[model samples]
Target: MAATTALDTLIDLTKEALDQAARLLAGERRTQQQVLQQLQTLNQYRLEYGQRLQEALQQGIDPASLLNYRAFLGSLDNAIERASQTLRQQQQKVDNSQRLWQEQHRKLNSYDTLVERRQQTVMLHASRAEQRASDELSARMSRNGAALLPPSDQSA
Candidate 1:
């Protein structure tokens, strides 16, 4: 019973650890999703900007204006690249967090299983001990009852 109590304490600790890990993983996943959304928004803006530049070229824009448009487009491309890289890094973090949480969850489950098996074993031993005690009491009662019986009249 003492061991079972200790195991229960350990299981509670393990569950708390697992919950913490899961929360961390969830936060990482949320951050990764936000980064992905930012990346997509950047790409869409870049595409629109490129289309505008093409239209201006078709309308015979001035050289100075053309140079400015191209420079801005180049910066947009760089920004888009940076966002893509950030998204990738964020994804890696999410993946790592997920793995950590899974490990913690597995460990917690193993501890729970151990506690359940141990409890079952303790119950089985208790049951066997009770049976043995009952058997001994019955044997003692039978002997006492036999001694208390009246003697038979076989000499008559």
Candidate 2:
């Protein structure tokens, strides 16, 4: 019984840990998604700017204006690269969190199994003991009943 109580406590703690891990994983995933969205937006903006530059070149734009457009595109490219890197790092964090959650879940399952086995053992012992007591009572009743009966006569 003490063991069962201890296991129950451990199971509760493991469940809490598992829940916390799940929350962390969820947060990490959300951050990763946000990073991905930002990266996509950056890519789209860069594409649009590049198209504008192309149009300007086709329409005979001034050299200074062309340089400015090219410089801006370069900066946009850099930003996109950084965003991509951040997304990768965030994905790693999400993966780590998922693993942590899995481990905690496994621990909880182990504790539950232990508790179940302990209960089964206790129940089996109780059942055996009851059976023994019932058998003893039945044997005692039979012996007492035989002694109470009168002896049969030999001659008819």
Candidate 3:
């Protein structure tokens, strides 16, 4: 029946949507964790470099001619900090996307639930309709049988 086919299609679509949501959730979670780990690594590098710079200064390093040292350190700090910030932004974006996915998944589940409820209601109505039609047919058949019987051949 067309109704059966339509129901199957709806179920398939819902399953696909759920599958995509799960995949997106997994990928985004993985990416977020990776970014966080990268940030941690960058922080470690920055701290180590900072300590090295401090030790270099303490070792009578010429601050005047070592302008390149300061420049390199500054560049490293800026690059690392900027990368960390960008990663944080990306993490937030991923989190937002994940939230949207959750919302969409919830809405899809709600829609599926509504569809199932409607299907049950429709099946109930169909059962009642069939029962009514069967009853009408039975009544008509009984009437026909009674009329066809040899009622006129003998008085009750």
Clashing pairs in 1: none
The reply for model 3, stretches above 4 Å from the true place, is 122-156
Arranged by lDDT with the best first, the candidates are 2, 1, 3
Clashes of each: 0, 0, 0
Error of 3 at 118 (Å): 3.2
Once superposed on the true structure, which residue ranges of model 1 sit more than 4 Å away at CA?
A: 141-156
Best candidate per TM-score, number? Answer: 2
**Top lDDT model:** 2
Ranking by TM-score: 2, 1, 3
Q: What TM-score would each prediction reach against the true structure?
A: 0.83, 0.91, 0.64
Estimate the TM-score for candidate 1. 0.83
Tens digits of per-residue lDDT for model 1, 40-142? 8988988998899899989889999999989998998998899889888988988888888888888888988897888798899999999999999999999
Clashing pairs in 3: none
Report lDDT per candidate. Answer: 0.89, 0.94, 0.79
lDDT of 1: 0.89
Candidate 3 per-residue lDDT over residues 1-156, each given as its tens digit: 676678768777877877777787788778778877877877787788778778887887785736867787787778778877878787787787788678767867877786789889999999999999999999999999999987575545
Cα lDDT for residue 126, candidate 3: 100
